[model samples]
Target: MARASVSPAPPRVSAPDLPRHLKRVEPARGADLLQATLHLSGDVDLAHSSLEQCLLTADAERVDLTGATVLDVAAKDLRIASMSLRNAGIRRLRITGGRIGTLDLSGSRLDELEIRDVRIDYLTFGGAKGSDILIADSTIRTLDLPQAEITRMAFVACRSDEVDPRGLRAKDVDLRGLDAEMFTDANGLRGTTLTTFQIQKLAPAIAAGLGIQIKD
Candidate 1:
């Protein structure tokens, strides 16, 4: 009988190294935070409050905001790592000039989300619903929207490396000023409204997907 072969073990994945200042603290309900740095764990509820220049780091749990408003919030070196928001009903939420790593928003509803001059890595909106989601002057590495519903999504002067729109139900998606390098599923944008220039930019990708040869 032949000897059975044993596969090698896979490499272990480790979590990110958090800073010393990131502690587990809870904020007052409906408290306003300005120019503060806090490391939080578990669920956080900041309902009906405003935050400006706030550096916040949270654990794997979701940040709950039943009704809150966030404006001009940023972290040290303008980078936020591993933040998740769930069931957050936010009004006038604006994140200007920051770098976010692993930002997840699930089952949340936002009136306006204006992310400007920011860099995001692994941004996901899973099972969340939003309207008027705008990303301006930003660079996103990976944008994943699985089973999410978005209405009137617009990208202005923004660039994205990969946009995975699997099971994403969006209406009126405007990509006039967007420079997307790769779209995982072009058919996912079947009902999207794009400008003539935008269509021209994506012609090559579209042709490649359809396996059509463009002969001059």
Candidate 2:
């Protein structure tokens, strides 16, 4: 997947602490959007398309962008039942204020992405590769990351009922602000950042993984 020569690559996100509430410059309210392509303005089936520097806001039951190469896009207030970006290459994308039943990014390559204020029932990154991704101020019912290689990802002020992290290859994945009920593979959390309080809260489960029993 290739990005346009006009759009520069985002800087690398370092370890330990991640920037909070980072945002791009949004277009002025009611400004002429003729320059910016309004994707999903007409067709919903945009599979295998190369969409660049677009703006979209919609309410749909299902929207598919499978195998698409999306770059430098800003979307807001998207209410969808299911949104799929499977096997796609997405870069420098921002999404806010959305409610989705399911968001599938499995087997995709996501870079420099930010998703905030969205409530997703199921969000999956299975078998995907990602970097510099942030999901803040979101409520997700399930976050599936199995077999995913992710770098510099953070979940700030987010809550998830379940996070399946089996076979996860991660670096600097901050979970300090995430309140997750379960992690299917506790050991898959290695090389990720977690606050002391979070680790203490999961002490029992961690001990159980090591076959250590604590008597009450």
Candidate 3:
């Protein structure tokens, strides 16, 4: 894990009290983004430019931006409520630290996406297509994996809100450091793709699928 070189540190605050709707504007071009720290109080818009090591601390609101781009933006140790990325042409976007309420990734494409040391409530990968999706040391509320294709994926030290059978879809899926409830649907369970605890959690669903009734 590489440390961010942009801003020294974000503004430290105790929780937040914001309205339901909030918006703020910040330009990515010529904003000293190389080592710049942005203290966002409400919704933030960071569109356009080459931002490397830029830190954004928002009030857990939706981050809306489009058309702007970046080369290697390392966002670490920041709290964001939600993020709305549409028509963004970004590459090598690494998200680390902080918790997002909802991450709506619709109509956005990326390369080499890595998420580590973050806590998110709802992660909607719907209509999102990318390569090399890796999630590690994170807490996910509900993972909606539909239409999002990945060549390589890994889930390490990760916890989910619910064991959604439809929450998983991948060509090469790696499940390690996971809980058993991640796979409760017997029919949707893949082959040889679970750990000991996971197997124990899905045993009842598997038995029920096999028409076996336990005599309590």
Q: Could you tell me which residue pairs clash in candidate 2? A: none
Lowest summed-lDDT stretch of 10 residues in model 3? 7-16
Winning candidate number (TM-score): 2
| lDDT at residue 109 of model 3 (Cα atoms) | 74
For residues 102-215, could you state the per-residue lDDT of candidate 3 as single tens digits?
A: 876655675666788998887776656655567779998777655554445567789896644443345445555544345545565452256677777777878898999867
lDDT (Cα) of model 1? 0.64
Scanning candidate 2 in windows of ten residues, the lowest lDDT window is: 26-35
Runs in model 3 lying further than 4 Å from the true structure: 1-25, 28-39, 46-60, 66-70, 163-169, 180-192, 206-216
* Model 1 C-alpha lDDT per residue in residues 1-216, reported as the tens digit of each score: 997642221112122233335333456567876656666555565656565445555442444444455544433324555555555654445566767676667677755566778888888877778776777888989888777887767787988898887788877667666787777776666646667876776787788779988889
Per-residue lDDT over 103-140 for candidate 2, one digit per residue giving the tens place of the 0 to 100 score:
99999998888888999999999999999888889999
Best by lDDT: 2
Q: What is model 2's C-alpha RMSD?
A: 9.5
TM-score of each: 0.63, 0.81, 0.66
Instruction: Please give the TM-score that candidate 2 achieves against the real structure.
Output: 0.81
